[model samples]
Every structure is written in C-alpha cells, then in structure tokens.
Target: MANIVAGIGWHVIGAGMAASFYAPIEKVKKWSWETTWAIAGLFSWILLPIGVSLCLLPSFTGFYASIDPHLLLTIALFGAMWGVGNVSYGLTMRHLGMSLGIGIAIGVTLVVGTLVPPIMDGKASMLFTTRGGLYTMAGVFVALIGVAIVSWAGHKKELQLKGHLEEFNVGLGLLLAVMCGIFSSGMSFALHAALPIQEAAKSVGVNPLYAMLPSYVFIMGGGAVINLAYCFIRLAAVPRLSLREDLRQPGPTLRTNAALAATGGIMWYLQFFFYAWGEANIPASMSYVNWMLHMSIYVLCGGIVGLALGEWAGIRSGLLRLLWVGIIIIIIAANLVGVGMAYSQ
Candidate 1:
C-alpha cells in the first residue's frame, strides 16, 4: 500500500511537472528564443539536476566516476540527440500550436519511447508474447488513434480559424514531431546504458533512486551542450542577445525570465526525479510502463490547459467535443498501459 501511494504521488508529480514546463517560456517578453532558452537551460539542463543530485546523493560523485568511459560517451551522445528533439519541439509548438504539437509529439513519444528499449534489449516479444505486453501494445495503438483524432480536430480548427490550409503547415509540424518522438525516446536507452553507475550507487548502500541522479547529470550535460551551442550561435548572429540587454528591458521581463527559468528547470527535473522514485515503487518487470504513464498524463494535462486557454476558440462545438473524446481515449490508453503493467507483474 505504501508503495502504491508512492507510485501515485510520483505520477502526479511527474504529470504536474511536465505540464508546467512550458509555462515559463510564456513569460519572456521581447527576449529572443535564444536568450530565453539559454536562461532556462541554465536551470533546466544544468543547475537544478546537478544541485538536486549533489544534495540528495552523497555517493553521486564516486558512482559517476566509476562508469566506463565508453558507456558514458554513448549516454552523452544519446542526450545530445534528445537535445535536438527538445530544440525542435519549440519550433513545432510555434508552427503547430500546443494542442496539435503536443498531440503529435506525445503520440510519437508514446510509440517510440515505449517500444525502442524493449527492441534494443532483444525483448521485443515481451510487447506481444505476454497478455500484459499485448495489452500495452494495444494501448499504444489506441493512443496513436487518439493522437490522430486530436490532430484531425486541430486541422479542423485551423481551417475554421483561417478559412484555408495555407496558414498552417501540417506536414512540417508532423515531421518535426516525429523526429522529437524518436530522439526523445532515446533517453530511455541512454538510461539503460548508464546502469553501471546505478549499480555503483547500490553497491555503496545508497538508495537506487539516488544512484540514478549522477547518470542524469551526465546525460543532461549532452543536452546542455547542444542547447548552449545553439544559444551562442543565435547570440552571435543577433549581437543583442546579451543577458545584460535582456535584463535592462522594462517591467517584469527580467523577473519573469528568472522565474520562468527556475520554474522550467524544476519542472524539467521533476520528470526524472519522479521517474526515479516511481521506479523504486514498482516491480522491475513493469518498469517500462512508467514512461508511458508519465507521457500520457502529460498529454492529458496539456490538453486541459489548451482548452482552458481557448486555443480552440473559433472551432465548432462539434470539433471541440471530438477533441475531448480524443483526450478520453488518451486517458483510457494510459490506463490500459497501467493494466498491462499490473498483469505483467
């Protein structure tokens, strides 16, 4: 019962964190994407994870030090790939709007993130051979269908708003979204590759949850490198991307940037933080479900926010109803994944 409570708490934390991540970006006024992303990156990809890992895990340094260089390199590369996806996501959201962007991104994330690790581990059959596995796969299919419905609703909304297709680029948005899914899913493989560091933490009598922190430090370093470079290039080209200039801007920009940076950082870290803690609650056999469940809740919360903000303002009431239906399907799909995990255990 305690474990179940822990799992539930972690899931809630994960969902809230994921949902709130983009809230900060909305606060940056007049700052270029380069400046805003860089500021947020300072906390999200760099400081927060390192600070938390250091504070919570005494053995973090030693555990990280003990990892094989080759394995470390591989994980770092995977993190870089995930960074590309992260960078692309902003562009996707800009081009596609949050409802459709998230729908497409999370949909691809669900399929690739759920399937790739199992396939890599040579346990692809686990997704089909067992009843639980089959159910989970079915959930994936259902979730994809939900995504399609949501995307279709977005298309309808766009047509209603603009009266034509030229205003929105569905093809480009989807392509970027698919890429985000593939690369974002790579983080799971990166985590698996860093198992040695995790074992080292266990060997030192630390909580396994604490052990995962150091690996995150290394993995996030890769993401940081990519984003940092992108920021620098933008700053260079624009010449006014200076933090000094950004701070000099009138009313709430600096304060908002700092607040957003802190919030986004904490929000970003919370995903892995809860993921690590949640993994401790569930059986190893059911661990993969954690990612699926996390992503599903994120989609649900994002969808709610999208509606609340009237992103679908001009769409017909019928399409709005279809949007809600899609959200329901996503929730059902998430529950199915949970059921599959329960049965697998």
Candidate 2:
C-alpha cells in the first residue's frame, strides 16, 4: 500500500513536469517551431537518455551488445511509429489548441494505451474478473469523464474569450488527435517489447528504476530520426530560418531560445523518468495499468497547469466553476486508480 502511494506521488510530479513543459516554448522567440522542437528533441530524445544511461548503467554498451538484436530492432521500430504520433501530437495541439487537443487525444490514448496491451497479452478478461483490475478499469472510466468535463469547460472558456471559436479544421484536427492517440500507445508497446533488454539491465546491477534506460536509447533514437528529419526538411523549405545563421550569431535570443528548448526537453523526459520509477515499484502483473494511471494524472495535472496559467481567466463564473469541478474530478480519478492498484496488490 505504501509503495503504491509512493509510486502515485512520483507519477504526480512527473505529470506536473510534463504538463508545464510547453509553457517555456511559448517564451522562445525568434526561432521557428521546427528549430526549437528539434533542438529540444536533441536533449530529450538523445542526449539526456544517453547521459543517464552512461551514469546509471556504466556497462550500458556491453548490456546492449548482449541483448538480441532482433529485440532492439523491434523496440526501435515501434518507437519510429510512435515518433509519427509525437509529431501528430504537436499538430493536434496546433490545430485544436491545448484544451480540446489534449482532452480528445488523451481520451483516445487512455482507452487505447490502457486496454490494448492487456488485450494483446490475453488478460483482458482479468479486468472484469479481478477486483483490483476492475477498480482500475473504473478509475479509467472516471478519468475519462473528468477529461470530458475539463474539455467542456475549455470549450466554454474559448467561447467566452473569443466570442466565437476560431475557424479551425475540426475534422483534420480530430483525425490528427485520433492518430496521435493510436500511435502514441505504441510507446507502451515498445516498452513492453523491450522486456528482455530490461532484464539484461537488471543483471548488470542497474537499479530496476533505471533499467529501462538502455531500451530508451533505441526508442529515443527512433524518435530523433523522425523529428530531426522533419525539422531539417522544414528548415530547408523555409529560407528565413537557417541553422547556419543561428549558429553564427549565437546571441542572447539564440541562447535564450536554446535554453528554453532544452528546459522543455528535459521536462518532457522527466515524465517518463518518474514513470519508470513508479512502474518499478509496482508488481509486473499490474504494470499494464501504469500507462492509464500515468496518462490520467498527466491530463489531470495538465488541466491544473492550464488553470494556474489563467487559461480559464475572464470566463464567466459558471464556466470557471466548471473547470475547477473538472479538475477535482480528475484528482478523484487519480486517487481511485491508486486505491485500485493497492487493492490489486
């Protein structure tokens, strides 16, 4: 019970970090979106993982050499598909805005990421037959309701702010959101696929919490390949934005933008960092539940971050109240998941 509670706490902090990561990107000036995102990916998807792997698993290379090449390839391939989802996630936010985009994306993600693995593992029946699994399922349903409420409040807030919503491509945005949700779930699949490598990490005296670091190398490598390709493609297409110029000047604007991007990247990575720790503390049989729990808290905390940033400001009192109520429900949902995990244990 205590371990479950602690794991939940770690997830909360990680979620908070993820929810607020984009705030810094808003502060980045004089850089194209492609530039900042790619730079940030350099840190989050490449450097940080390598750095942490080296520090934690000094024999990281040896561990990787010992693992089956097919397994590594498989995990990295899954990550490549997930990279497309990561890219689509950014597009969804661009087309739909944070509130609607995250809400819809996470709702789909919650369903897919949570249930698909169990179904694939042939344990879908356990959700109904097992007490803890059933409770976890209930928590997922509750969190979905919470996401809907928050999205509703956001819609109202949008109406209040703009008098009418901006003319966005609702169909396209929804498509992107759905795609993001489906593909993002590949991440969980990637992690599960790398169990052998994780076990290898364990054999090398790496802490269970950090055992996943080696797998992240291939996973993140796949993402970096896609992201960097997209960024460079955009950079080439856009005559205005030049990596050469940015490098030559290296002024305060460049420095500041780089710093902000780095911060966002690090913040983004922390979500999974603590996710690993949280999962490490839980029993393997129930680990599938971790994705849903993590994402529920992620969206929940994201709502809180939006609130703190005054995203709900200037809305009518009623709508603001709705937003608050929605946040509370998400909190309750997270608690329910924790309790369910404890019960399952």
Candidate 3:
C-alpha cells in the first residue's frame, strides 16, 4: 500500500510538471518560435537527458557497451517514431488548442499504449483474468469518455467563438491528433522493448530507481535527431527565423528567451524523469494502469491550469460547464485507476 501511494504521488507530480511545461515559453520574447523551440529541444530532448543520465549512471558509457546493438537500434527507432508524434501533437495544438488536442491525442495514447503491449505479448487473456485488470480496463474506457466530453466542450467552445474560427481546421487537427496518439504510444513501447537493458542494469548493481536512465539516452537521442532536424529545416527555409542574429549580437532579450526556453525544456524532461520513478514502484501486476493514470492526470491538470490562466474566460457558461464536467470525469477515472492499482497489489 505504501509503495502504491508513493507511485501514485510520483505520477501526480510528473503530470503537474507536464501540464505546466509551457508556462516558461510564454515568457520568451523577441525570439522566433523555431529558434526558441530548437533551444528548448536541446535541453529537453538532448542535453538535459544526457547530463541527468550520466549523473544517475556513473558508467553510462560502459552500460551502452553492454546492450545488444539490435535492441538499442529498436529502442532508438521507437523514440524516432515518438518524435514524429511529438511534432504532430504540437501541430494539433496549433490548430485545436489545449483542450481538444490534448484530450483527443492523450486519450488515444492511453488506450492504445495500455492495451497493445499485452495483446502483442500474447497476454491478452490477462486483461480479463488477472486481478484488478477489469477495474483498470474500466478506468481506461471511462477516461476515454472523459476525453470525449472534453473534446465536445472544445467543439462547443469553438462554436461559441465561431467569429474567430477562420484559422482553425477541425478536420486536419483531428487527423493530426489521431496520428500523434498512435505514434506517441511508441514511447511506452520503447520502454517495454528496452526491458532487457533495464534487467542488465539491475544485474550490474545499478539501483532499480535509476536502471531506466540509460534507456532514456537512446530514446532521447533519437528524439533529438528529429526535433533538431525539423527546427533546422524551418530555420533554413526562413533564414530570418534563424537564431543567427540573436547569437551574433546577444542581447538581454536573447539571454532571457534562451533561459526561459531552457527552463521549459528542463521542466519537460522532468515529467519523464518522474514517470520512470513512478513506474518502477508500481506493482508489476497493474503497472500498465500507470499510463492511464499519467495521461488522465496530465489532461486534468492541464484543464485546471487552462482555467486558472483564464483560457476559458469570457466563454459561454454552457461551454464552461461542459469543461468542468469533463474535468470531473477525468478525476473520477484517475481515482478508479488508483483503486484498481491498489487492488492489483
């Protein structure tokens, strides 16, 4: 019970970090989005991960030597796929806003990430026969319903703001959201596929808490390739959007924006840091439920933050009511998953 509580706490903190990751980006001034995102990715998907992983694993170089080349490539490939998903998710947000993009993409990610592994491993029967499996499954479906409600609220909000709808493309946004959802599940798959690496770490006397650190190196490495490539491509296509000017003549704005972007990236990386911690502590029997819990809490926290930031301000009362209802459902689903985790333990 104590371990379950601790795992839940870690996931909640990770979710909060994820929900608030964009706060610092709002402070970036006089920097192109491409430039700032590139800097942020340097930290989130590259430098910070490498630095932290080294701190966690003193012989990180040796650890890589121990992993099978084929397995490492497989994990990296999964990360690369997830990187595409991450970019698509950002595009979805551009067209759909926080509510709809997050709700739809994360909903699909949670459901698919949770179920596919067991099915692929030929343990589909466990989903029905295993203790707490039923509750976890219920929680997943309920979470999806919650996401649907939230998506509906977003659509209604769009209707309320129809005068400003010229720039929004619901169809494109939904398609990107679905694609993001499918590919985002790759991260979960990467972790599962890298189980052998984790086991190797454990055998080498590495603390179980930090065993996953090395795997993240490959995961983030592949992500860095995609993110950096996209940012560079954008910068090249629009030279004026590049950070060359900012770099050549460093100013207060450049310094501040770089710092803000780095901060955002570090915070973004912390989400997965905490996620690994939480996942490690969860009982193996119900560990799959962690994805659902994380996603639900992430969306729920985002909804709360969005409300606090007045993103829903000046909205029609009906739309606001719908948003609150969706949040409540998510909260309920999270609790159900938690209870299920406890029962599985």
lDDT of 2 by residue, 1-345 (tens): 888777878877777776777768656777777888888899989999898888888676786788888888898888988898888877776555554566666766665665676788898887788887787688678767866776676555555656344533456676787788788887878987988888888888988878877789899888778878988998888889887765555588878888998998899889889888888876766664575467666676666666666555566888867766766665566556656666765
Ranking by lDDT: 3, 1, 2
Once fitted onto the true fold, the runs of candidate 2 whose alpha carbons sit more than 4 angstroms away are: 1-5, 95-101, 121-148, 162-173, 238-250, 284-289, 325-345
Compared with the true structure, model 2 gives a TM-score of 0.83
Question: Can you write out model 1's per-residue Cα lDDT over 265-285, one digit (the tens) per residue?
Answer: 677778788878877786677
Alpha carbon lDDT at 276, candidate 2: 85
**Best TM-score among the predictions, by candidate number:** 1
Q: Enumerate residue pairs that collide in model 3.
A: none
Better of 2 and 3 by TM-score: 3
lDDT of each: 0.76, 0.74, 0.77
Model 3 lDDT, full chain set: 0.77
How far off is residue 242 in model 1, in Å? 7.2
Positional deviation of 7 in candidate 2, in angstroms?
2.8
